[model samples]
Target: MKDVLPYFLFFIFVENVLDLFFEEDLSWNDSFTSVATGIVSKTWDLLLAGSFIAAFEYAGTCYMWNNYRLLDYATDNKLASFLCFLMVDIAFYIDHRLTHEVSILWLGHVQHHSAEKFNLIGNLRLSFLKIYRTWTYLIPMGLVFPPQMLFFHLQANNIYQFFLHCKYVPKLGPIEWIFNTPSHHRVHHARNPKYIDMNYGGVLIIWDRILGTFVEEDEECFYGLVHPVNSNDPTWIQLHYIYDMYLKWKQQTTWSHKFQSLLKGPGWRPGSPRLGFIAEIPEPVKGDSKTRIDPPVASSLNLYVVVHCVMVIGSVFVFMTKYEKDNTNKVLALYLLLCYLSITILGRIYDRKKYAYGVELFRLLFLVAFTWTNEGSMVQFLRSICVASSGFMITKIMEPPESILVRA
Candidate 1:
């Protein structure tokens, strides 16, 4: 099926809500569902809708491109316009293939294939990584096709691609030889040796056949990378590979390796690390889950938690010692500091999964030790001892049971 169905329904949902208000029916049940959660969700639903809308624009631009056919032949030169399309499209074909070969491009392109399911929502996945950061190959397009013609064609090509990212469609019959289809695309998304670098197409699949890069999809196909990125956390999934690349690049010994890592093959890693190919595919777990972790019982100090604790202690000191004077000012400053600390700790816990309640407790106290703020400038020097005590207490509480870090 076309990837637009769900998006269309969502768009309709918005319209349907408008109808209830406009039709003189002030009843709450006039629409199928309420507007607050109907039209969109804060997370994945919105991203999918955005991707769908983006793809829809591709359709509009393609319509314009097709209507403005033989775009290069302003002088009624049919042969020249066709030639321009051919030359420009060939370059696009090559660029698409290079995306897999280039680490930078893979980061973005992986987003397209990262979804385990082949539904319309899966097609909407996007990573901040550049699909093809540099379009150096397009400089020659200026020789014949005007930038406007070429630009619209590129958009049209992308719009045409949204349809191929589905599961309902079969091979394009004999036209499969010339056009891209869902089956061919399945091969492109697979990490199997036969499917690794094949089926590089935009709107047409003949490019693969012509370039000798074609590989047909068989009945058995495994999608995603060899080591599948199976997280439902969109933020984690999108940025995982990028962070891995960054850490690898940082630990790299030399500039050449660092530079080469950027252009490594589809499976390349820092040292050509083993576990290089096959993956032990796991059974899919249905539904989303929010991770809950235990707070550390002991730690010298956790950074965010420590900062959080200091504020709590500062608030206490504001009340305990009146020597600093400015009583109302001290209370206000203390209250603001403690509130800011708690909010920050909660945000940090949400983002960093391993944060257990133990960690929070330590953070709570680290916060309690920073009361010197109300002590004014005179006793600010006492902050170091307070900080150390907080750190030690956190460390004592968080010291592991020994087996935690040392994997058996």
Candidate 2:
């Protein structure tokens, strides 16, 4: 699986390129943000994979029922694989549904749905905190299956889910009834009243059908949260909902009400104008008004940002592949810093913030200083040159018109 990581990345990149360039189904900023978030999520996954595996091993060894331990039985029996897969699918369905229904859980799950555009890149917009809670859901399965089997099946489920984020695939005639396809999963991502909280299955759709949580694709799906995130900042995308819940908790007059605000469904609030379950549908906002800032930027600047983002992403891949256990802390810190600076600078650029160029300059200077202290590789020098030149171009292009500047 480690060896095949590049292939997986390539497949996702190709799909995104086809969708953005050929299909024209996504916006440049939306796609860029989604891809950036996905890259950040993958970076965290690489940094934390060892810790999660250790935790899983410990839990499975200590927590399983003695007589019910199915490791030997499952290993010897070919049928056990299918049974274990079924168990994981069911576990994911329940966990995914609960995340939507419980406000606290929603805090960790909301980032995955914050994107207004549905594309393969959106699949990468996962929450970092999700690693902590998602393992808990698999603990029950640990009671039966071994930790190894549980981990394998969990990855299988997720890999199947990756391809489900696209809009290119239409409803498969018979397969749609059994497996969770692109069409069915689209309903899960939508905020439409008819589609909200439906189709929670990871690999199988039968759980949703049997449980009466399934809704067939009908009306055009509007992708995103009830209230659009409207910003491309990855930090804000992950934390805004948690902050909103905290604020809501603060507004409560009593402790119990405060707990309710934190634990209740997203629609729940205190007092009059309380919304019923079905009536909690979000009022539609005009699409044009969804974006808060849209300053005109040169096409060359936009292309530069995209190219620089790709370079950062490739650098991350190289770092992860060559990362060593001995220097794990140093490598992880530098990698995360690079990714953070890249995304933050790109987000500021997309919003046309006047300070974007300044931040980009600072980031380039930091990179140069860091390189100078090390080997001062030619690759680093060339990258710094490209980034600085692009930043200068963007700064000049985004300058206000002379008349507006004079009035100010």
Candidate 3:
């Protein structure tokens, strides 16, 4: 995890560009309030789906952990289980493909791809527009692999992909083949004609090759969905596509046009001005400039998350020393005692250009062993991450309320 710290910094840098463009002081308190506003403003989807997914992921994690030993053994020798993982990942790839092709599945996936920018937050983005969307692959995985192996495989795949989101590295020559590379993912995000709807593989690029949907990254890759829309506000991101479709319908001269517009495929171009097209392919200009989103986090938040995690590292140690004891110290270290207070407080405060250097006085004690790193103090480190994660959840909860966000 420490090795992947640079990628987090890279994410911040990208986000900073957007923060400045929008002149987003985007305070923590405002974010929290905005999230609440979004939740209250939601339409078209109830909280039930979100509730179910939350419970599903939590329950799945618990069940998987109980069988960790077998899972670990399978992973201990990569070559031994490579064939097995490949078979299972095939199911994973198929599941991912369906998310784009199926209308109902796209509803859930739209919440994730809805983000305008490509950054660290984008990597973690998932939605509960419908229950089971987040863990949809588990159903496919269950058909073959045990629950424990499925969980570990899923975790490993995500951990690797998190690093792949970085803009820092250009390409890793040989490694690019066996595993999904930045180049491959760049193609995945492309909105161009030949590039669109291609490269759906996660761990292996061969899946795309085998499926005949593979498109190599040759021209410069432009990352984002078609019909340029920009906003770091998670609420806006969630509702953007859905609301855009409604606006497209409202703009249409006839109900037939409106009905056809919504029913069209991913790359469809509509007659309405609001959403000229639900999707598009690049026509190719003589010279179309590329766009970059944010500046590298003048400070990286990765170290901040790591420090917060370390606080809880000694939890087992403390537990053994004081069995059946309630200790605030370890709780302070993990920083997860009260999930609501921790999340809410962080949501209410934020500084876009923040590096968190002076936040932790306690870190000074271990200057020789630990640098101040990215965050201010240890406590501030926890605050920063909690703010980000909670802020996003709040935004998601607020967007597309159960009633209706916008009319079709």
Candidate 4:
């Protein structure tokens, strides 16, 4: 995961520029929020790794079937690798399908579908709780392969899936029938009736076809959830679906009905609504005018915010690349806190909040002091101070009249 961070960052930058040049219907705020959420999620994963690994080991050992070793004959290097990759892909397909069909699991997946745009950044808008939900699927693979091999295949599967998030790739004529291409994954991300619950394979499209869940991309795709998340706040994006489930559960009168609300599909309801969360699929729309929130920002303030975002990205890259695995907890915690602060402040700026500049100023100062004291890196300290100073000066110079600012 650490090794792939730089590549992910570079691809996102390239895609954003291409979107601008081609005038694609992209949401800048949504893209930024997606990337920020990914950073937070990656940090959280590092923090949770030890506990998750222990649980995985316990489960795998307890479930290992000594008598029925299926892959015993496939011990050749190439054969073992191929078998592991195939098994992992199947596991991902089942895990993804269950997340959509089951209500509680959907809480861990809805955020990925909340973005109205289908760019590379949108692919990173994943659920932080996903690790908890998908770990069990890999336990079966432990019976056939060693843990190290299983881990390698799992990472390879993930890397392959990342390329499927792009929009510029057209459908491959013959390969589309065997492998999961960009076109197939696009249908999976669509909110249309025909596209929902289809194409769950990670690397291979054969699983979808064999299981009768494949849907061809015949028409234009409408991305995002049917019930859009209007706000760009990362915290709200993470918790909103779970909160909605809680409220729905509270409304139920019987215990069985309440449990069903948690176990059934996201569209599932108790009494009158027989649609079961899969309501009538609306026709495809042109622009995402309803969900996109692009508040007017002054050119100077926009530059300041963009520059600050780049700094945050750089900080994240450094943290991921340099931090040693043994003593990462403290640094990871502080890094995650800083990331959350930066994202919240950016959301405020997107909303045109008057106090956002003050919050950002404090964040920059805190970051500089924290880095200087912990690592004693003079170069990083000076760089952060310079960025903060530039931002402060720009905000002061572009400040609106005091009377107008006070009215808000």
Candidate 5:
């Protein structure tokens, strides 16, 4: 059997390319930030959470094998496969819905909705700090089915959901009844009070329909949170909601109120129930009043950011592929450091922070010196270009166009 990784990657490339032709407001800066944040998020999974989850699943699998042997035919029977897939889908629905209803869980999920525009790349904007609730929720399935089978279906479900993030796909007439279509997903991502907390499904819409969480899309879907993050900085996007919750916790008068403030729904108040009052939800910004959260940066800087983003993504690809075989701590640490600094610096540059110029200059000098110390014709060539590009970027940073440098 062929690996799903290649097809998944190819689909991402095609989605991004098609998005340029099909979608409006194709902000290159926002897209670059998505890719950078995605790199960091995936790296976090690989270095930490991935191993823990695998170990837990493996232990569960062994326990099931040694004890009941009830689901021994899971890998062979078609009925077993179908059941496993259904179970995974249901688990996803529960996890997605709970994340929206619970305040603490929302902290991990808010990053996905932070983007103002809904496009294919929007799927790439994930929270690096997001706690893994899906895997734990699938524990009952783990008690019966094999981990390999469950893992395959979980990945398959995710790949299917990836296509739902875009706006290009039209409503699929009859299929919309039972399956989760892109149109249904658009309503789920919207912050409009009418659509909030609706259509929480992975592969099938039957759960939402049966549970009374379904709503038909009758108007233009507005994307993003009720209160927008208004930033492209990955760090800020990841922690801002958590910080807000902390402040809310501090403002409460009693212990019960403080605990409820953090544990209840994001819209919850002292007098409100666990899910909070609907009146607390902000009205969606409509028509001309609605504005996206894009900051200004020079064209030269845009090109620079895009080029470096591609390089950083390529580096991540190399690191992940070699991760199992490469045991050198120093090499791994250096790789991680480079990826983090590259994106953080580029994000600050996009935000047009004055300190970005100085930090970037320091990074360039370090690269040039590091490359000089290494012995290779290619290394020397790279060092030479680094010197020239460093000078060019310095000039661009020092004298940005008056029009492009204006803050939003």
Candidate 6:
């Protein structure tokens, strides 16, 4: 996982450049939010080495060890391997569908759809809360395939899905009929009334076609949720929908409606069907009249945030590569604290909050204090950069510059 982190970072960099060349409307703030969320989620996963295996593989290993195998054949066989892969894809289809259809589950998934611009970084914008939920659907498949094979196929399915998040790809004529293409997935991400809850397949569109959830890409997609999360804060992005659901649950007068508010589809009303009535879904407002939640940011602030974010990412790499496993709890906890603080400060800066400057000063002070005692070349380097950045921020704040301190 540590080795592959750099590659994912590179992919985001490449996508950013590509979007720039294509003159695509891109939001660096949203992209940073995705990266920050991923850093926390993936870093935690790395901290717990067994996190990649997670519940799905653990259950599969237990079942396989007990000789409760369904297939009873090794994955070395080509046909068997293909079959196992197919089963995993089917598992993803079921898991993906449930996340969309169930209201409570959608809260765990809403962050992925919260990105107004559909881009590759959007793939990294996954919910940490949604990570463990897949085992519920994938565990049953464990009866057939071994844990290793299940892990491999799941990763492959994810890799395939990652490419599906891009915008430049046009509809492939032949592949569109069977496999989940970029076009198919754009519909999946869209909040358009016609496209909502459609194309839930991970790698294969056949499951959705047969199951009747598939919708063809006929028009340009208006990406993101109908009710957008108008903030870039990773913490808020993760919690907003869950809080929204809680409010929805409280609004219901009857006990059954309260429970149903959570269990039913996101758009469900008192008299709607299990997945809600389509007629009730409003036709999405389109074109220039519709705007995304992007606040204007000064170029200098963009450079500041970008440079520090790269350092935050470098800190994760340094911890992973240099630090030992033993006696890491204290160090890891502090690292996590700085990470969250960094994310919050950066997010607030992008959102143009009045308190962001104060929070930035606090975070810099916190970093200075931690790095003062810590040993290592990387630690020293980080301390120097933090000090320099702090000095720069202080100068700007003292100026009371319109771009830095005084804002709308």
Using lDDT as the measure, the top candidate is: 6
Off by over 4 Å in 2: 1-4, 20-25, 43-76, 271-276, 283-296, 373-381, 384-387, 390-398, 401-408
What is the TM-score of each predicted model, taking all chains together?
0.50, 0.86, 0.52, 0.84, 0.90, 0.90
Instruction: State how far residue 228 of model 5 sits from its true place (Å).
Output: 1.3
Clashing pairs in 4: 267-277
lDDT per residue (tens digit) for residues 171-222 in model 1: 7788787888888887887656667778888767888898788988875555
Q: Could you tell me which 10 consecutive residues in candidate 4 have the lowest summed lDDT?
A: 399-408
What TM-score quantifies how close candidate 6 is to the native fold?
0.90
For model 2 the local lDDT of residue 9 reads 76
Off by over 4 Å in 3: 1-51, 57-84, 114-117, 134-137, 247-264, 269-280, 284-408
Number of backbone clashes in candidate 4:
1
Please list the C-alpha lDDT of all candidates, in the order they appear: 0.51, 0.73, 0.48, 0.74, 0.76, 0.77
Ranked by lDDT, the better of candidates 3 and 4 is: 4
TM-score of 2: 0.86
Model 5 C-alpha lDDT per residue in residues 1-408, reported as the tens digit of each score: 126666656776887788768765556666776776677677666566654665665676556655756646636678888988998899889888988898999988888887777766778778765446554655556667776777788889988898898677888899999999999999998877888889999999999999999998988888777887766667677678978998999999999999888778898987787887776677775541136666556676787777777667766777767764554556765776777787788788787776777788888788887677798896686567668768976776676445445345
TM-score of 1: 0.50
Residue 374 of candidate 3: its Cα lDDT? Answer: 48
Candidate with the larger lDDT of 1 and 2: 2
RMSD (CA, Å), candidate 1 to true, equals: 16.5
lDDT of 2 by residue, 158-224 (tens): 8889889877788899999799999999999987888877999999999999999999998878878
Give the poorly placed runs of model 4, Cα more than 4 Å off: 48-77, 271-279, 294-296, 368-408
RMSD of each: 16.5, 4.0, 12.8, 4.1, 2.8, 3.0
